[model samples]
Target: MSKKGKEKEEETMTFKLETAPFDPRFPNTNQTKYCYQSYIDFHRCRRIRGEKYEPCNYFKKVFTSMCPNAWVEKWNDQIENGTFPGRI
Candidate 1:
């Protein structure tokens, strides 16, 4: 196959986007707490299990999909600055 053909094939390939699955603990319509919790859980899991642990990716995916980009950015900044409100 030609380079252009392979590139076109890659571009045309479909990738599905998914949101976090439902959790009974956060059954309410509002998912604010769910998002926040996932964020904290992700960091906590990383701290406890180390960065290479695969399960921690789940929490990261959940928060990234559910939380607003701006909120995630702010929280990331807070974490970097050691001012994140949640205990992680």
Candidate 2:
């Protein structure tokens, strides 16, 4: 493909794989699942953008703003123990 075509494709390819339900607060359960998914999305973003400071900055901001510290800590532990559900 031409450079211009590739640029247009990249622009259109911007996507958010993780999304909250229509009414996130409606669920009887706590928001643990929401936080966990955002954590996973952060890692996925890093994986796609490479392990660099700049590329993953947006995701870092997103998860940090949305997910709590305790949940993120637990998820990190699970990841270290090789038991996290997501591939990343």
Candidate 3:
């Protein structure tokens, strides 16, 4: 594909949180499965130095202290793999 075409495709891509009735089978480890919008909000806040630092609080609460090392591992895996099952 042409570079222009690829750029257009990337621009058109919409990253949205997939929503449905919460799956009891879903592992809470997948940050993408929970309130995904919330995740995005938190992530952005941290990146932009937004006034609200608490946006990513859920991430810290659930992933950081709860399973600290695992969170880093998951992030590394996502970086290597391009996309994870839940988190974009």
TM-scores for candidates 1 onward, in order: 0.85, 0.53, 0.30
Clashing pairs in 3: none
Candidate 1: worst-modelled 10 consecutive residues by lDDT: 79-88
In the range 27-53, model 1's lDDT, one tens digit per residue, is: 999999999999999999999999999
Q: How many pairs of residues in model 1 come into backbone collision?
A: 0
Candidate 2, RMSD to the unseen true structure: 11.7
Better of 1 and 3 by TM-score: 1
| Cα lDDT, all candidates | 0.96, 0.70, 0.55
Full candidate order by TM-score, most accurate first: 1, 2, 3
Per-residue CA lDDT of model 3 for 55-87, tens digit only, reads: 556544443433347655776587578775444
lDDT of 2: 0.70
Q: Rank by lDDT, descending?
A: 1, 2, 3
Judge candidate 1 at residue 71 and give its lDDT.
Answer: 100
Location of the lowest summed lDDT over 10 successive residues in candidate 3 = 59-68
Residue 35 C-alpha lDDT in model 1: 99
TM-score of 3: 0.30
Every candidate's CA RMSD: 3.2, 11.7, 16.9
Q: lDDT of model 1 at residue 64?
A: 95
